[model samples]
Target: MSTKRDIIEQLEKNYLFAVIRGKSFQDAFEIAKASYEGGIKNIEVTFTTPNADKTIEKLSEYFGDTDMVIGAGTVIDDITARIAILAGANFIVSPNFSPSVSEICNRYTIPYLPGCGTVTEIANAMATGVEIAKIFPGGILGAGFIKDVHGPIPNIELMPSGGVNLENMDTWVNNGAWAVGIGSALTKDITSDDYTSVTTIAQKFSDKLKEIRSNN
Candidate 1:
């Protein structure tokens, strides 16, 4: 089993979270496999999918056997959080912070990346042992918001989601983002039945992240 610290270190080192929302299990699995090949170790399966649990299960069974790690995204409550963990989710991510969700993740000893917009929410989430807090719809806040909040609490780790792409990826990492969650920019090719494109995009993001990490 991978320890919490191990997963945390991997996230910090990789600096990229491949956010995936599959319409079906096969689609999700294919996308995940492509991502793994492209060097994305962290994958987030959103709950809104038709059979998200099963998708996570399949992913965990396949990717968990290797160095890759899986997480549950769009997790709304404690019930869903527990379900995802039992199904083999190594981490939990929510669009917004929830006390119940955080508590459940704590019980499992898994990392939680709950969304927080304001300083107060971030502080509250930090109190619950959340090492990283996600800024949803990151385009709205942009890099300025991250610099502003991080200026005060330099220790707080942040990940931006909802508008991240290859073009602006550097801005987020340069601004001190522990990682960035990429969605359509990484998986949009799946729609055209062109899975190879997924791998190409994933590799591009991974390479870019590594380049910035090296420079910094």
Candidate 2:
């Protein structure tokens, strides 16, 4: 198995991971490209959409040669993980901690970000031999909560998702969040009428992240 640092390094290569959850695969593809062009090299396509496997396969085929790292989100169990992996997902993300899902990802040598909201859950995820955990509902927990949690488990890599925007991105990063998972804030304004809007938003967010990194 690859070391946790190895996975962290891989994730760090692409600071932004776009979360795409909607009804249209075509729209998702366009949104993905917009993000990719705007400097985000990672994308997470959720499984709740229709023909998600097909969407993953299409994205894998389309961006196979690029440096972009495409992954699957909302992965629940081992079966979904296997399907996503087969469809060419580079990683798996879940909304809640699932050892079975992590084990499958580990078996396949793929990185998994298991969702954890509490100290016990974070410890449990680390106990499974997976060091990266996603702090879900980041809006509710806030950056202060993350800082408090890391006081004891500084070794744990916590990626906060949900309610993350350009405004508070730096706060999370500065407060011990290894990375952040951003959704609607980055894609909501993007409509089929104009694709440039998507790329513009992505670039703005990327620029903000860079500014934050520099200041920190």
Candidate 3:
């Protein structure tokens, strides 16, 4: 497995974080693996997925030995964070900031990306050594929000998720997103039994991200 620092760097460099939120562990695992095959090295399996810990464990065991990084998402508290960490999660992500969660992750030297909707939230999360803040519900907040936040905190790293699709993903990166969390956009119409579309979309997303990076 890569070091925590390496995992953090990968997320920034790749600019693509595949969010795996499925109904079951089997389903999420396959989706995550398909995304990985599609070239997304950073994956986040939400805790809301049934047997999330097992999914994390399975994926971690599979990808931990490679350059791929897998993490736990939707972690709301310190306990959940710790559970995921021990389950071999390379990092932790939450919908909102939690000091306890941050503290625990800090103790493990694990990277934490907490959801932040405003400049104040971003600043606070950054103060806790969080490398990147997520502009959650990015669709509602819009790519412009990232630009607006970056105006003053130009040095802060931000990854916007939610409502991010091929149509508008470029907008976010163009506006100053360090990375992005793709959910339904990447998995739309994809099911465990039908993953060919998942791979197809993943490749499109990966190519789009590369194209955007070249322009930047």
Candidate 4:
């Protein structure tokens, strides 16, 4: 099997990973489909979401035929990461850097993207052999922050999450983000009665991303 870093490399090559965090597994699944239709081939279902493990299983089965990869987010420990991985998570994302969690992913060959905000934290995550690191609360840190970090650690693959949206996605990508993790911005209200609207929003976001990349 390929290593976790290999899986993450493939995901970065693909360009996007839809992040879903909500109160309902069914709703998260619906939103995930909308993202898939929007051209996103990767999705992350945060553990904070209700029935998160089941959500991963259902999404794994639902997208079994496609190249789409489903992962578990907000993983804080090795046990939760193991459970989620066993439940069919192709990748694992943590809100904070945890060497133990990274160790587990390395053992299972599952991709791991751990969260970090400061240079020390980023360095710590990288020291554990995790290549992709999530810059949480993007709105607070901003694209400039990412650019600043890249000045010193140009080799680290950085992804911005939290408060990422259509308005700022281009800036984030332009500023050296390997990819971005979108939550409420992309999944909010996607499970409403208006499925078409949900799909439309998803497509719009995806289209915008393509447009930005094309111009770049």
Candidate 5:
């Protein structure tokens, strides 16, 4: 099994997490597969989807030997966190911080990335051993928030989720985002059964990140 640090490094190297929400298990699986094919090494399947646990299980088994990382998102409590881990989630994420969820993730040695909107929340999360704090509603916070937060807390790793897209991805990286999470931008107008657009969009994102990293 990969260590927590190993997974963290992988996340940083990839610099993008495909946030997937599907109406069904097959929908989730296919989207994830398409994302992987498009060079997305990290994927976060939100619990909002039906049979999310089963989807995580299948993803873990399918990508068992690859460097791809599968995570559970929208995880709000310890019970859901534990369930996701048991179902083979490599990490856990939530829209807001939860102490119980943090404790369970720490106990299991899985990386926990909880949404934090303020310096106090980020500091509180880091105090509980969180390595990366997700800046949800990134569009609202904007890339400037990362820079602003780094001024007071220089070492905090911030990954922006929600509203992150190829157009503004460079700005986020330029402002020192640890990583980024993309959702509907990757699927957009594509129908449930046709994920070709997903692959196309994911590739663009992958390429954009690479270009940004190279320039930096």
Candidate 6:
């Protein structure tokens, strides 16, 4: 078993999370496999998909020995968080922060990345030991939001999800985002059943991130 610190380090080092949401288990698995092949070490399977728990389980078991980290996303409550944990989720993410969910993740020693739109929400989540907070609908929040948040609380790590693409990812990173979650942008090719295209896009993003970090 990996300690919470190990997973946190992996998350920071890898820096890219491919948010996978598919119509079925096979769909999500194929997307995840392709993303991994393209060098994305972190995969977040959202609960909106059918049988999401099963998908997480299969992905965890298949890549259990690899450096890949699997997490459960869109977790709305403690019940769902517990279910995902029992299914082998390395971390739990929510659209918003919830104390019950945070407690469950704490009990299991798994990272809880809850979404926070304001400094108050971020501070409250951090007060309960959340190390990283997700900025949902990041398109609207923009990179400036991150800079603004860090101005006061320099220790908090923020991850922006949604509206993250190759063109603007650098801006987010430049503003000090710990990581960025790419969902539709990363999985768009899956709609055409073109798994190879998915891998290519993932690789493009991976390479882009490397270039950004190298320059920084």
Question: How high a TM-score does candidate 2 get?
Answer: 0.93
Per-residue lDDT tens digits of candidate 6, residues 109-193? 9999999999999999999999999998799899899999998999999999987999999999999899999898877655567
- Give RMSD to native, each candidate: 1.4, 2.0, 1.5, 1.7, 1.0, 1.0
Record all residue pairs in model 4 with backbone atoms less than 3 Å apart, i.e. clashing: none
Question: Candidate 4: global Cα-lDDT?
Answer: 0.83
Whole-model lDDT values for every prediction: 0.86, 0.83, 0.86, 0.83, 0.92, 0.92
RMSD of 2: 2.0
TM-score of 6: 0.97
**Model 6: residues >4 Å from true position, as ranges?**
none
Over 70-185, each residue of candidate 3 has an lDDT whose tens digit, in order, gives 89999999999999999988889999988888899999989998998888888888888887888887878999997888788888878887988888888887888888889987
Score every model by TM-score.
0.94, 0.93, 0.94, 0.93, 0.97, 0.97
Alpha-carbon lDDT of model 1 = 0.86
The lowest-lDDT stretch of 10 consecutive residues in candidate 4 is 187-196
Question: Mind giving the per-residue lDDT tens digits that candidate 5 earns over 99-174?
Answer: 9999999999999999999889999999999989999778899999999999989888999998788888999989
- Over 1-216, each residue of candidate 2 has an lDDT whose tens digit, in order, gives 134455457677787888888577777777778888998778888887666777788888998877788889999989999999898887899999898998998888888898888999989988887777888888888888787887998888788899789888888888877778888877777655577877888899889989988987
Task: Return the top candidate by lDDT.
Answer: 6
- Cα misplacement distance, residue 142 of candidate 1 (Å): 0.7
**Which 10 successive residues of model 1 have the least lDDT summed?**
186-195
Q: In model 2, which regions exceed 4 Å deviation?
A: 1-7
Better model by lDDT: candidate 3 vs candidate 4: 3
Model 2, residue 136: distance off in Å is 0.5
| lDDT per residue as tens, model 4, 27-136 | 77877887888777788999888989998999888888777888999999999999999889989998899999999988898878898899999999888888888998
